[model samples]
Target: MDIVLGLQWGDEGKGKFIDLISENYDITARFNGGANAGHSIERNGKRITLKMIPSGIFMKEVQNVIGTGTVLDPVSFKKEILNLQLFDHTIQPEKNIIISKKAHLVMPTHKLLDIFMEENPEYTTIGTTKNGIAQAYSNKILRQNLRVGDIWSPDFQSRAQHILYRDYKMLEDGGMIVLPALEEISKEFFDAVDFLKKFTCTETEIYLNNALSKGKRILAEGSQATMLDIDHGTYPYVTSSSTTAAGACSGLGISPKKMGEIYGIAKAYCTRVGNGAFPTELLDEFGDDLRMKGNEFGSNTGRPRRIGWLDLPALKYAVMINGVTQLVLTKADVLNGVKSVAVCTHYELEDGSLETVSGTLSENIRPVLKWMNGWSADFVNMKSGSELPEELKEFLSFLEAALEIPVTYLSTGPGREQILKMK
Candidate 1:
C-alpha cells in the first residue's frame, strides 16, 4: 500500500511517519522534488535530514529509489550519503538505493538562472530556495536538459559544452549580465557529471512497476505540500512540480490503480516557508510562540517559516485533491502551553462574500476563525491513546468533525517512537 500526504504545508513530519510505516513496505520511492526538500526523520535518538534519498532508506529490508520526476543535486546527495555512512557502515547505499536516469540534472547554470530571476526586483519573487529547480525544469521543458543517462555518454563533454555556450549566449541576448568564465562553468559541469555517474539507473519505472506486479508494497513520497503544487497551488508563488496525488502517477510512471491507503500529514497549526498568500498567518506574539515552540524553519533553506492558526478549509481542499483516507497530525505537543487555539473555518473575500479556502480565494481573501480550548499538558512521553489529555482529544475531534477525515496517527515529538496510533 502506498501512503501519500501533505494535508497542510510541506513540513508535515512525513519523514518520521514514512519511516515508521516503511517497515511494512518492501520499497520506498521519492517521486518528486530536489534539494529543495528537507524531510527530517528521528531514528535511534538522532535527527537526520533527507534530501534526494527517501527517508525510508534507514529501514533494514527496504529499498529506496529516486524516481524520474526528481531533479538530482549531486553535491547535496553525495554529502547526505557520506553523513549516513558516518552513523552506519552497514548502510551501503549502492546496494539499496537507485537514481533514475531520466531525472533532470540541477546544473550550475540552473542555479545561475534561479539567482538571476530572483534578482529582478520588479517581478514578484516566489522565495525559492535558489537551488535551481525552476531553471532545471525549464531546461527540461525546453528540450535542452541533460539527464543522468547522458552523463556517461562519450559525447557528454561536447554536448555539455554546446549547451553551456548556448545558455550563456541566451543570457547575453536577454541583456542579462553574466559572471564566471565559460571555461570554468564547463569544468564544473563535467565534474558534477562525473560525480553523478555512480548513482544513475536507467529502468526505474520498469523496476517500480515490477515490484507492484509482484504485490510488493510501495510508498509514493511527495516533497512539498499540496498548496505548493504548480498547477493546483497558489499561482505565481508555488513550486515547479505537481505535489498532489495525481503527481504520484506522472512522477513515478505508475498506474493510479496501484496506489492505496492515502495518508495526509499535517501539523496541529499551519506554517509556510516562502512568499505566498496565507490567510490565517499570525504576525504577533502568538505566531512567535508557535515558531519558537515548533522550531519552525525551512529544513532545505534554513529560513524562518511563517506560522499561523490551523486552516481547515485549506486542509479540506488538500484532502479532496489527494483523496486522503487518513490524517496524521504532527507537532501537537508544540501547542501545549497555549490557552486557546483558532482554526480558520472559512474565508471572507474582499467583496465581503464567504467562501471556502482555496488558492484563488486564499490569495485575495481573509480568514474567519473558530476558537477552541487549548490543551496545556505535556504529551511528549505519552505513547497510548488513554494517556492523551482531554483537551487534546477534543482538539482532534474538532479537526475530524470539521474535515470529515479520521485522524489515525498523532506525533507528539520528533523521535521515531513518538507517534501514537489513534485509530
Candidate 2:
C-alpha cells in the first residue's frame, strides 16, 4: 500500500531505503524501468547491485513481483536471480518472485538498435545506459514487442524471428552494414525465453487487488526518479518511462485509491547523469570534492555523475508532481567533514531576474545559492536524531520547512543498520 521512489534524476539511494523498510511490507513490486536501473544495496558488509530484480529480494519473507509495465531482458534477469546465492541470499525464484504475463521482453535486437543509436552522435543522445531500454520501450509503444507470456505461445519462435527480421532491417536503414547474426543471438535468446516460459507469470493487477482485499501490505518500488520521467522531465535528456507516482498506477495496474504514503527519497546533495541543463551544477573544485566524498558514480554504467547543490525548486517540483507524502534524506553524513555547504534557493533567469524554478530549464538560467555551515561529526557511534550534530539538524530542519515535508528517514551510511528514523 506504500510507495517508495526517487525525487532526483536517479541514484537517490532508494534501493537502500526500500531494503531498509521492506520488512514492513508483505509484497514489494517494481513497476517500471528495466535493466537500465542499477540499485546498489549494501547488506552484511557486501554490496549487491541489482539491475532487473527488485530491491526487496534480500528479505526472505517478501514476495517480489516485476510488474507488467517493465521492459524485461529475460537472460539478464535469470542470471540475476541465479546469482543471488553468491551474495548469501539464496532466493527461490518461484516463491520469492513472479513476472507479469503482460510484461514485454527485451529482445536481442533491441540491444542492436540501442548500439546503433548510441554510436550515432548525429542524433540527439540522452546519454542512455544503452541497455536497450529506449529501443525496448519503443517497440512496446509500437506494438511490435513480444510479451513474457508470448514465450509460452505455440508460434513464439516464428513471431520472434519476424520481429528480429524487422529490427535487422531497421538497423540497415540506420546505415549499419554488418547486421547481427540471427542464429547466434537467438540461441541464447530462445534458451532464456524458455526459462521465462517456465518462470511464474501472472496477471498482477488482479493478483495485487486480491491480496489487498486480504489486508496485505504492498510496497511499490519505482525506477529512476521523478526528474527522469519522459513526459514531466527535461525533454530529450530524460528516461523513457514514467518514474513518478503516476507510474505506479500505469506500471503496476494498481488504483490510486489503494495507495498509502508515498516516500520520496533524495540525497542531501543533488546529482545527475549524462547531459542536461543543470542549473545548480558545481563545476569547480567543490563539485569534484563532493563527488569524491560521496563516490558519485553511476551504479549501472560506472560513468561519473554530475554533482550539484541541492535545488529546492527542482525538489519542490518533484514533490508537487508526485504528491509525495513524506521525505527520506539519504547520504546526509556525506556532507560531514566539509567546511561549508550550499543550497540552491532560487534561479536567475536570462533577464537578470530571480524566479522560483518552473518550466523546462535551460543552460542560460543560473542558481542563486544559500550557504550553510557543515558538520564534521562522523555519526558512526550515533544511533538516533538526538545524537546528530547540531549543524546537521539545523540544515535538515531548514530543508524540511522550505519543502513543507517532514524528514522522517535519515541514511548515515551505506550499511543497512546505518539508517535512523525521526519518529
All candidates: TM-score: 0.95, 0.97
lDDT of each: 0.83, 0.87
For model 1 the TM-score comes to 0.95
- Model 1 C-alpha lDDT per residue in residues 168-287, reported as the tens digit of each score: 887777667888877887776676566666654867899899888898999989988898888888777888888988888888999888778899999998999888888889999878
Off by over 4 Å in 1: 169-185
In angstroms, give how far residue 248 of model 1 lies from its true place. 0.4
- Per candidate, the number of residue pairs that clash is 0, 1
Per-residue alpha-carbon lDDT of candidate 2 for residues 148-176, written as tens digits (9 for 90 to 100): 88888899999998988888888888788
The 10-residue segment with the lowest total lDDT in model 2: 85-94
Clashing pairs in 1: none
